[model samples]
Target: MADELKLLSTWFSPFGSRVKLALHLKGLSYEYVEEEDLMNKSQLLLESNPVHKKVPVLFHRGKALCESMVIVDYIEEAFADAGPPLLPSDPYERAVARFWVAFIETKLVEPWFKMLDGTRARAEMADGVKQMLAAVATLEGALAQCAKGRPFFGGDGVGYVDVALGGLLVWVRASEVLLGGVKFIDAARTPLLAAWADRLAALDAAKAALPDFGRVIKHAMMRRGAAAAALAQSN
Candidate 1:
């Protein structure tokens, strides 16, 4: 086989999972190549995504696509017939879905990556958690508006926003444990989002694409522990 479609990814990368979700949802088959060491980059990955030098470089028909969301967009456009649509058919609704995807990237995703960063002080990390939680509350409201009381942000089915946020579900679950039981999406506070998580998780696509929670948590623990040690040394 010429390997028409190939995915270069790390096991626990939510970004990688996003690409996986799109592939799985579209029911597209591809070769999965795990990047063993990020520090030691593969020539293929390096050539594919020289700008970022990151995992989740998707090669389709010998053409390389970099970035997670970009890959999803590609899948949605290129393989529209492969499965159900993720973006909305209505232009306005499509715009709305894209808007939420951006929000998740900035408001939720940024702070998440910020929290427990080894270079930053613990206090700064605490601030990150606060910001992350605030984003969650905002997303709770967003889900109501976007999903229109439906189970997913995509309403009747898993759409753009669902994949955007759902990609991070495993990370969010791992983070909850890593952060000493802080509930980002609380049933009491953000009932819709809390329920949405459970519902999205139950889907076949999620089960297929989402990384193993235990593996992610184990990796996250190492990072958190290192960050904590760095903070202690700086104190």
Candidate 2:
């Protein structure tokens, strides 16, 4: 019997987007339950992820799995025979993939959040942007090493690191718009990485999994407005 699968996610969450991308890459058909308000989460979400109470929780065969990356790994393992492999078969390659995924989750994302919240002064925010760009440069180098002239990090296919970083493109693009057209990834600064991002965006799975660009921009604008208001009030 086929296992019943359900994914609890929120539309704007890049973390949740990772899980969606993994599922699509695996060609897994599952119910997507959107949580409208995270503060007032659904009972199902609460019950499914009592510890984190977070979205991107995967329920397979009546067991709940929390954390976006963890859920993605689980999907890759459980559906190993169902679709293209997310992780490379070679242990060394798999370890390298996991390393970059960890770098993306731990090193890159927090600085991005700080930049997004806009709580820092002008100099601090500039430094934050520099930090983010440095992280991108590191990723670009890693991709260049692994891509080996292929379009993706996984050599003609999207793999673990691809899903890990690809999901954040929306937010990164939105942040550029929010910052009055400050370019983060572009042909001039990050040509290879920028091209890779474009390729990822154009993929059918990405088009299906990612939220609309307009929606992301609008949400980002709202957050920027709120941040600006808060900054004004503080002065």
Top-scoring candidate (lDDT): 1
Candidate 2 displacement at residue 106 in angstroms: 2.0
**Clashing pairs in model 2, backbone N/Cα/C closer than 3 A:** none
Error of 1 at 4 (Å): 1.7
Q: Which pairs of residues have clashing backbones in candidate 1?
A: none
TM-score of each model, in listed order: 0.92, 0.91
lDDT of 2 by residue, 1-235 (tens): 1339887787777877888899888888888888776657789888988886777788888999988888888888888897799899999999999999888876677677666666577776777777888888898899998889999988888999999898878878877888778787888988999999999999888987888889978766776745332222110
What lDDT score belongs to each candidate, Candidate 1 first? 0.82, 0.80
Task: Give me the displacement of residue 178 in model 1, in angstroms.
Answer: 0.7
